[model samples]
Target: MKQFPTHIVAVDGIVENEKNEILLVKHRDKEIWTIPGGQVEIGENLTDALIREIKEESGIDVTVNKLVCISSNTGTYEGYNGYGIVPTKVMLGFTCSFIGGELSVSDETSDSRWVSKERVLDYITNPNLIERFKAYLKFDGNIQYIEYITKPSYDLKLKIKI
Candidate 1:
């Protein structure tokens, strides 16, 4: 039996404009549109990391207004070199407000856009993102902390949206 490698800590920035449009980036490497964020750096605050990621990916600066949601994700990716590996990821989803900066596509993204929360489906590569976007819209400042243990592969956990 081949054991899987453990996943790493990752974060995602969900920046919403005044009109409630969430920003997304289509990465050239993956060629898939996703939230504007990456790894949660060691010893850096989550909000800070998210802001930096957003700026680097979409040329947009932001302030994390609140935590929108959290998810535990795990999957397998076949490397281009013909090696297969399990990619386990724990992602923190934030609902951020765009503070400043113009929308310019960066090196990390081949394209970028602001889409309505309800229309995240139109832009996202992952199907479950719509569930998180729904929680971000109805957030009332009282709810915080969504924890899930994703294991056995493909058994994603859903909670913290109360």
Candidate 2:
């Protein structure tokens, strides 16, 4: 039998507190800030994975409200050996409401904070993350879909609200 390529499925949340602030976390290995999230483990659903990731990375409890966007990207990563092309990553972005828990960082996160909506873009500079955030802002009872390639160059393949 021939082997086939596999894609990674991940989940990210745009958690909002009563004060309208957004939860952002900086991973230990990453310099840029991004919303808390991680890959879904086997036997875990998207919402469950999201909740667990949020709690693990930021020590914050949140309720997944709705999915805002679904994005796929063919991006590369730097490994111990050298730069390698990573499998296509399919991420589901959700809007979540903060339930409870004191804000704290974990081993995976170097820092975590609640940033005002106006200043969120200033902290998150990744183009892909910025696009996901924009999709969250534009969410209107509809889910947005985005597909892009980041290897040779950043090229947007498809973007539409469904």
Candidate 3:
């Protein structure tokens, strides 16, 4: 049998409140702010993972409405042996509706709050995340596909509404 490359499956949610503010969270170790989400555990479905992640990280309840976009990127990280290993991550971004829950931070997150769309870019500075935010803003009941590379250089290979 031929060995196939392994890819990480991650999920993120773009949650908006009735006030037209977006939910954002800051990780304990990261400076930039991002939407609430994390990796999917083994045997867990995408939507379930997203719900669990959001609840754990931001103490917010959200309902996954629809998939807004999918992004694939390959990045390098330090391995256990101090060697660099490249891994591909396939992330699904979803549009979620805020259900209920008091906004609070978990151990994984330092702060959580709703930010206006105009100020989102001020908090989210990562190029890739900025692109994803743009897709969320331009989502018109259609799914988008974004392909990019983040290790060697941040290059957006393809972005199209499908």
Candidate 4:
């Protein structure tokens, strides 16, 4: 019998401004546009990891409002392929309130900006990226569970509030 390794835990923040726009960051290395977040280090709390990641990537302060959804990539999303062939990531998504900070980019992020719901598609072309925001739009203040499958397309999303 073999022991399975621990799954990587990640956090994504949906930071919204007074204009009702969401913040997205472009990965400096990957060039992929997604919500600001990263892997949670060992011994770090989920929310704390989220705050640190957002600030590190976007240089902004945010107050975590509520958990939006919990999703498992299960080798479907290639963006988290940093671990090589074995892809397993549990992502905790949260709705955040923008506190204050000047727009700045970190080494991990090439660009950071706010995008309206309608204009999100213009910046993010990845199906997985688009689906993330769409899931948030349908968020009804309930926790959503998502499982992604990339067969025909990246739209294989199953979101259910439990």
For residues 72-140, write the lDDT of model 1, one tens digit per residue.
664545545675664656677787889899888877889889888778877775545555665666777
Clashing pairs in 4: none
Poorly placed runs, candidate 4 (over 4 Å): 1-5, 76-85, 149-157
Residues 1-162 of candidate 3 have per-residue lDDT tens digits of 998988889999999999989999998876669988889999999999999999998889999998988999866555555645647889999989899998999888999999998889999977888999999888898888999987566998898888
lDDT of 1: 0.74
Residue ranges of candidate 3 with Cα displaced over 4 Å: 75-77, 80-86
Residue by residue across 1-162, what tens digits does model 2's lDDT show? 998987889999999999999999998886669999999999999999999999999999999999999999866554455646467899999999999998898889989999998899999977788899999888888899999887677778889998
The Cα error of candidate 2 at residue 24, in Å, is: 0.5
Clashes (N, CA, C under 3 Å) per candidate: 0, 0, 0, 0
lDDT of model 4 at residue 126?
68
Instruction: Give candidate 2's total backbone clashes.
Output: 0
Provide the overall lDDT of each model, using Cα atoms, as 2-decimal numbers. 0.74, 0.91, 0.89, 0.82
Model 2 vs. true fold: TM = 0.91
What RMSD value applies to candidate 2? Answer: 2.1
Model 4 lDDT tens row, 62-98: 9998887888766533444464444577888888999
Q: Candidate 2: lDDT of 88? A: 82
